[model samples]
Target: MSQSPEKKPRLDDPCINLNLEMNRKAHYTDSFENPSLIVRRGFPINITTTAPIDGVKLVYIAGTKHPQRDSQRLFGWKLETKSSETNNYQLTPPSNCAVGRWTIKFTIDAKEVEMQATILFNPFCKDDQVYMECPEEQEEYILSDTGLVFIANSWRIKPQGCGWVFGQFESRVLECCLALLERSPLTPTSKSSATLVSRSMTALVNAQDDNGVIEGDWSGDYSGGTDPSEWTGSVDILLQYLETEKPVKYGQCWVFSGVLVTVLRALGIPCRSVTNIRSAHDTENNLVIDIFHDRHGNRLESDDSVWNFHLWNEMWTKRPDLPDGCDGWQALDATPQEMSDGCFQAGPASLNAIKSGAVYLPYDARFIFAEVNADRVYWREDSDGNYRIKKIDKKHVGRMVVTKAIGCNDVDDITDQYKHKEGSEEERYQTRLAVTFGTEPDIYENVEDEDEVKMKFHCEEDYIIIGQPIEYTVKLILKDMERATALFNATASVYGYNGKFICNVQSHKCELLLPEQKVFKGRIESSEYESVVRSGSIIKISVMYDLKEATDMGFLEEEIPLRAPPPKVEILSQEPYIVGVPIQLKFSFKNRFSSALTGGYFRLDAPGFSSRDRLEIDQKLLEPGIECSYRVEYKPRKKGKINLVVSFNSDQHKGLHTYKHINVQNSKSDDF
Candidate 1:
């Protein structure tokens, strides 16, 4: 508050700033109660001496959370240096402090300087507070020790502090941790944010590797590209899948736990990690009860959601004798999944193996979970001072929850909406459901049981048109196709380049007399890319269809499904299809109001597409509002279901696709 910009330097040029950056302050704060908060505001202490002081010393005194018997005196200590500045001096608290009135005394060239601060024994209030007011709750941030996360509070995502892993990247994790630690108090009794930040930074520097990487034991590889923005770091899913499929697999992901443990241990910060069972991601990643093993030679396996592979650390006071409220340890993690992107607190139930010592094992009974979770990390902090978590990370899905979220794959490029199906965890958090099974986000005119409504749409699964006219067919299917003559509507366009006209259809549908496929004989003209662009641009030929809720005048057990066999746009061309080369993509399609247009978005991910081995386009805007076909040059990795991402600004809506290859299966390959 002293002039927002800079702190006024009292006294002149004979000063210096010392101490460590991050990760360095923790070890120095162990013996002190509630370390003072470190701030970015630099404090310069200059004492001009007639004759340079031989051994100058500067002292800072602060109080602990409570004035206990051991720390009889306040956290008071003097840092001695040959020069006055102490050159950014750092300190580790004395193993023992005589608990009493605390004060600081400094001497420069024998010119004495003194300051004092007090520690209070507020028995009624246990949580840390600065000034006279305390925060309702502390923001959770993940910290790593021994390559694992010590999850204290929830990260901003997944609201309400649910554990989630965003990505497995060091830079992202460091940025998140630093942002939070910079807010903690430095001294136990002192409300000094600067103190905490400075010390934490120092601690970080000491633990970093020569390559500047901060991980202790975790691998350096990270999955997913940044721009495409698909980050899945959930541990439970992986463990669950391994457990179910390869029940004899060894080595649980302890490297993650080790990272968290290492960070806390580096600074004498007491912490523990809690772990539990996890649900599966999809049919692809099933939670199988396999033989889970660790580097330490420990192994276990069971078909349990409560004991799945997981790791979260807990923070505690450095001393075993310290009381409950004397600045307890905090938890954090690099695994967004374990932390549920910061869903729970750093208390007892994070993960156990990640703790400094074997702490979580002994404190296992004190775990709890959420009860009525609308969207919250359920944990119990009862009046009895006991803590527990239940329903450990539930992906309890029901009904038919469809999401507008698409998968980040080739077919659904970056432009499509993500289509989430029923029974998937993403069905709730990612996709768009027409009608929810559990809770309804909105009630859009709940029609009577016998009422009928019509939905229509136009779609196309496109390929190149060589030289001949490509005939395509579109259909609308129903459970009782024989009962209702499902109304169908569609339009087709045969336009040349820029503006050269061809033909257009405003509306059309299926009929027993009319042809199901359209013929475009001599519709395409051979020309260069530039010549094609020179002619007017091509237009889309669309077909629309709809069906009303079947009404046999009485009982129909289930609602009939209307299917629009996504229209095909194949280009009959003279140029042959390359086995492994990208050709200019020139295709078009139409849109209708179809239920399958779930999120109006999709992704097109072709493996052998880019020469640079990079994918950068997002293609999910193919919905009705944005009509027509798209033209772009793209290469295919292999033959399969060409997905098209159809969402706009829907970061979570990159479409999911199942690529189909001739005589081949798409296994979950390790991208890293």
Candidate 2:
């Protein structure tokens, strides 16, 4: 009689909890496996459970927080089960899905389970339904305010602190952007984004103001300021101009493109930042950057120059005005170098136009093509000042153009997508086709030289601290016995990223015999020019020499003595902080230079810090030789090791950072 025990709980009953199967969780991995998994929008999301359920519903919520299912839910989806215990839901997240960490609540009858997932906007998605709505672009490019973008000095995308944090328009920023937008005659049409982006190309750069917005100084230094993060974000750039009606100081190609990304995204256009290494600015549209040198091996200045890296923006949209397949990923350059129409804007240069060699596209397709795929033509000058194409290098122009991966920290190489691989027959043909568009093909005979003057020009170190000296050693080996006297001249000028000339710092001119006198040197004491220089400024050194008094010249260009301002803030804190314990974080702001600092403000920004932790300096002016100290009392809200970053900005000094880390111990009494 007592053998009739209590019945076992049924699997489908609300009392029985549903948990994800261990094998399912272990095997179904995402490309990026942080606490939150990232899945491309328009792709299938599969979930395998250990228990069978009657029905399933998914509720998307912002961030990782999950309150009881209610109207606060972003969206809900009824999942379709592949089997009783497996959920192979082919759910495509719309582009409008918020870009950030999101929690998805899976409701299985009365029991519920939740997991963290991040939805990313993928521009390359080809699904007709997704593309028609273009949700990915709408969410990522237009709606999202902040994101990670890649910037580089060269092809290889190693994080040398080159990645930039980009913030688009918030409410205040949007207000200013709207006012600016009114000035431009842009209306919502099929080609509205392309048109607005074109206007932004020139409008973002203050060409009229010297050292303000964009510094195109080729003779001077290129440093806009201490750090790229000094502007804080795109909104800060707009507010500075809108409030003051004065052009903001400092901006490079990256800065210009970053601002363009903000403006375009704010206006409901899909956009992102792109960087091209060894990028060419084909001012003449000849598809060749011609450099002339005297008979000796010295480099001379030309109208066309190649930058270390070039930054531009790409907006995703449909091109009803253009032919088919040229609809997505149009390049928009905000850097005020080349002018499109009467303004300094560039594309909506269709990448498809780039691939297809469609030079007749609405925007500047040929210019964008040359930027990433142009062949460099090195011209040699003779004794009579006559020059011939010495050598053409097709392989060195574009190497590794990269952008931030859709949902991760890694870089995504879109080089091949922009142009065919170097040395490929298709690439050569495309180059010729792209160059010869709307013009008769000229036979480039004798472009390759049988004998070329080999020169080695390098510095002891590529980077030098501000207030230091930089030395460049040049060596030339003559291959022709007919070469006579060589006149070597090395000129150093400071310049901004906008390619504008600042000031000539140093110049050395001398005569040497060919083959006998091959070595020449030049030095620059950066400290002498420290007062006029900032970090990211360029010390452009050009060495040009003539051989046998022949006009055939050889040229070498090098940038030396990179400068950065001294740090303004210092941090000191004890590690292993305990949760619920008040921690004393001490820091100091000391002016390192002779001048006073005005309008100084510092902000404490991190996940672990409270919003009220930021503060401005009590005194508007920070006097030289004075050290200001501050002590902040902070308590750990969560138990973990966390990084805190404090950034300082002012009218005198633009960028400075103080960072600290603290590990908090979890305790029973530490519950918030």
Candidate 3:
């Protein structure tokens, strides 16, 4: 009898077993072990087969639907024989492969077996577009999941670093990120390009355009959804979206940015949240923020206003679509501030282009340029009801642009990276260049300086913390030696961060003779505005001067941000906490207000140590001058330095958060 034909290898044969865990550590994706194998592009991942088989050809297909040949490739494996019956194959995805789930078909003779894997952007690979040359940046932007989001107005209060848990490597986050891309209108070809993906993500992060992720609610009423301030991380929001296939109820600028950073980082593209203090929302794209006021110096409702601070995201990638040298950090906003191409998306605009004032480039560069360098033009309604420019503020729009520093929680001021020094020659030149391409190129033409009397405001304290009296001084200086009498009015109002008027706190009016220099002091007690210090609200003190000697009036305003003191956190567990070991933490806060604080609650969030849901403890009331404390237990799941954030909120106080860094040692040894 002829030799029996060799048995054909079957798809379900026990001879072949894929090693899903192989090369995951090298790809920096060992943290994700779920639905399928996770690997980054431009890196070699080993797939082992139990039984060695000859004539095996592997074909890789990228994406799930309508897979194209451009993204598909065939590779003949060298087949490293691990043992007598086992073989390991190393497969390297193309550097430009589309990111998402990929199918790998193993062709043995005429038979085929298919396996699945997920591919991500490779910032570590040189050939990849998102490649980051610096090793430290790759660690901080791509690897470090916990970061700080700087809060507070830079001019009024010092920008404080608020701990934000990115949770990029959390369970189902990678899946959710891929699912988000699939939900968008991006094709497989567009998904392959980092620039396109980032641009698309800007719209996908908010539900305004595509029913994407977070539903933005700036209405101050968060009855049906969670308050934006209560959110400590993005994992819960994303998982909820993945589960419900609906937008998460409410998010502001920071929330949108936090979630975008998580999605970008989860896709293996380096990203960080950026805070632009005194950021402008230029609705007209005229390179000017117009503030119309009555002849008496009261702020009138207008179309354009400058936010106390605005938060957006910066993603690192090469912009091949633009000219050369635009290959670094690109600004992208998902806050739905304005529309781009009929969609609520902002950038992927190159920071290099932005710094150079090349606003003529693509993807909402004019809007972003105006955000950082727009001139604030004060327009006063004259007796004839026509608005005329009284004062032009060129340096107040973008005071300090900042982000979380590398390897630490401290703030890294990248203001210089975004623009030159304020009032500098280069800054002025760039501003002019930007205005040339703006909607109103002649906006600065014939703008006469009508201010004969100059006024300035200064805060007495280094920081005007909440629950303390605010003391500030207003000074008037005659630009020239001319005797003049002027009527001065100073009004203080509680304004939302978005420039919405909340409630007026105090107002003062007086007539004074303009000496060479005149100074006036004002005070507003904590009791006057303590109840109105909602999340991100600031005290705007506007001073209007009616000069008897001149035809034009003077308007000067200062935004005073009241800083909320962080709550205290104490780790009850002993030092040298180990992985998988239970650790107790105690959170406490003293009610500094004179009145009782009702609806008080404590929110605890620790990325690696706790579950996706934040631990919330309810307290009906916190007596004045009394310290309230809550204790909870958590088990360390992984070994590393993790940030534990504790936030305290009540009907009386909002936006009080604190964080503690805890070192979790490996259970195998003392090494962290």
Candidate 3 C-alpha lDDT tens digits along 1-672: 634234443434454565556667888887763646788888877766654444434333433445445222343223444454446667677788778776655544334455667889999999999999999999899987777887766554557888788888888888889888776677776778888888888999999978899999877778888878877778888889999999999999998999999999999889999999999989888888988888767778888988889999899998888999888999999999898988999898999999999998877888999998999987777789887776688888999898988888787889887899999999999999998887878777656576787787898675666788999999898888478888888899998888778889999989878784388899999899988766788898988888877775777888887677679999888888888888988888888875788877778777654433344446567777888788888787777667877788776565588888878888646863
Worst 10 residues of 3 by lDDT: 70-79
Give lDDT tens digits, candidate 1, residues 544-586: 3233433211101111111111222333332433435445543
Off by over 4 Å in 3: 1-13, 33-35, 50-86, 109-111, 294-296, 382-385, 608-619
CA displacement after TM-score superposition, residue 138 of candidate 2 (Å): 8.3
Model 1, stretches more than 4 Å misplaced? 1-14, 17-275, 278-311, 314-364, 368-618, 621-672
Residues forming the 10-long window of minimal summed lDDT in candidate 2: 24-33
Error of 2 at 337 (Å): 3.5
lDDT string, candidate 2, 1-672, tens digits:
423223333434333322323322332222111333445454455655545543433433321222324333334333456665354443345443433334554444334555555444434345321242545445555544445444344343252233232334233454444445444433322112344434443454444422223433333222553245443345556656677755665665666776777766544456787878778887777877776665556557778877766778787766767888877678877777776666666777788889777777878888888888887777777657887777777876767777755544457778877888788888888888887772325635567444335678777775655556778888877776546677678888876543445678888889877677778877776445656664345677876665655435556666653534433333344545677777776656767555677877665543334222346777778886676655667776545434455556666555455345445677645532
Model 3's TM-score against the true structure: 0.92
- Looking at candidate 1, the ten consecutive residues that score lowest on lDDT are 553-562
lDDT of each: 0.26, 0.57, 0.80
Residue-pair clash count for candidate 2: 49
Tell how far residue 645 is off in model 3, in angstroms: 1.3
lDDT of 3 at 390: 69
| Per-prediction TM-score | 0.26, 0.61, 0.92
> How well does candidate 1 match the true structure, expressed as C-alpha RMSD?
22.6
